[model samples]
Target: MGSLIDRVGIVTGSGRGIGKAIAEAMLHEGAKVVISDMNEELVKQTADELKQKGGQVLGLVCNVTVTESIEKMVETVVNSWGRIDILVNNAGITRDALFMRMTEEQWQAVIDTNLSSAFKVTKPVVKVMSKQREGRIINIASTSGVHGNFGQANYAAAKAGLVGFTKTIALEYASRNITCNAVAPGFIDTAMTQALSQDVVTKILDKVPLGRMGTPDDIAKAVLFFAGPGAYVTGQVLEVNGGLYT
Candidate 1:
């Protein structure tokens, strides 16, 4: 994909799962990538592996909930590379519990990780993007944001907020060449989902007409579309479910 040739990118929570896949895909497309995660060791290992494959890669620890961490990560990217072209806000957490029994900390933790983190990272990128007047941003949302799930009020609210945030950013940057959009994934086979009870997976599968869960690659490819081909597409939420909602 020469379209993304020589582009620079950042993928948050890229130590593993869908984030890792997106980082890999971006590298395959000839883009230099910055992989950020809370796990310094994992990010370092993953970045090293990608580098072994001759990809331009940088790894760093970044807690998206902290503005300083976000700023440091971006600074590291600029110092290592020279610019930022694409950004994927994929870092998120889950503190699932029934609302009736959920504590304030539980609800706040999910929102902070899923939604506030987006604001933290995107804040710096926006300035850089606005200065350059060209950029691509993809926020990794979830199906829960669209169709609420049981015991995921916080996650759902955060994901839905991402959709709204994306739309607003798109409008704000429309005059420039920047595009902001969201990719809402459903039932992806990641570490987190794999840990779910088999019965839970089965119950979820029953709702999906596609008869199978999505893969990290599925989400990665969608991210690639937004970062490259979907330049004209912005302020939209592309649900990457296996026909779960439809």
Candidate 2:
């Protein structure tokens, strides 16, 4: 049997990209997973695909930034599965701009979606996990947050905030057997990166010792380690950056 046998996991923004990869990894390990995203069609499509792979899946539309939507999603998950063993805060967006050129709206939008959404979603999930005395929370962060990229002021701040949130949750919930950690991915070859010009991609990748962009599965593997029942680590930030120091 897989390590996560019957664990119930909620992966936000799981319709595609890294989020979808993480959800797929958990499902392959025998977890019942919730594929949640703001895009209802994408959520349904992802859930259907996973189900065809023999996974026990649920698709829910959730706007993590909204308290009402978050509460509803949490309620639905609990009603269906009776418990939540894992929560992956994988939903995020980027609004790239230099700090001087960044607007208040851009900063707030990124903060609300990437950082504050965790506060909204985790409150109720943590309550449920507390009662159960066991749970895992993995927040998807970014290397840009750590090293500070030139054109990603808002995105960087939001992800950096997420890292802080992860550590605080870890400290506060350790006694409850709930582990919270962050996974900071570096130069991942996702849809976002694919949009960059080859020159830009090459320039970014040249700094990596491995000389290649990381894959979604690379991030998923790290997440799986944290999500596994046997993990004894918490309050840590694991950088899955193909030997890239920055």
In lDDT terms, which candidate is top? 2
lDDT tens digits by residue: candidate 2, 1-246: 888999999999999999999999999999999999999999989999999999999999999999999999999999999999999999998878788999999999999999999999999999999999999999999988888898899998889999999999999999999999999999998887887889988888889999889999999999999999989999999999987766
What's model 1's lDDT at 30? 94
Per-residue CA lDDT of candidate 1, range 108-211, in tens?
A: 99989999999889999888888888899999999999999998988899999999999999999979899999999999999879878999899999999989
- Steric overlap count per candidate: 0, 0
TM-score for predicted model 2 compared with the true structure = 0.98
User: Which segments of candidate 1 are over 4 A away from where they belong?
Assistant: none
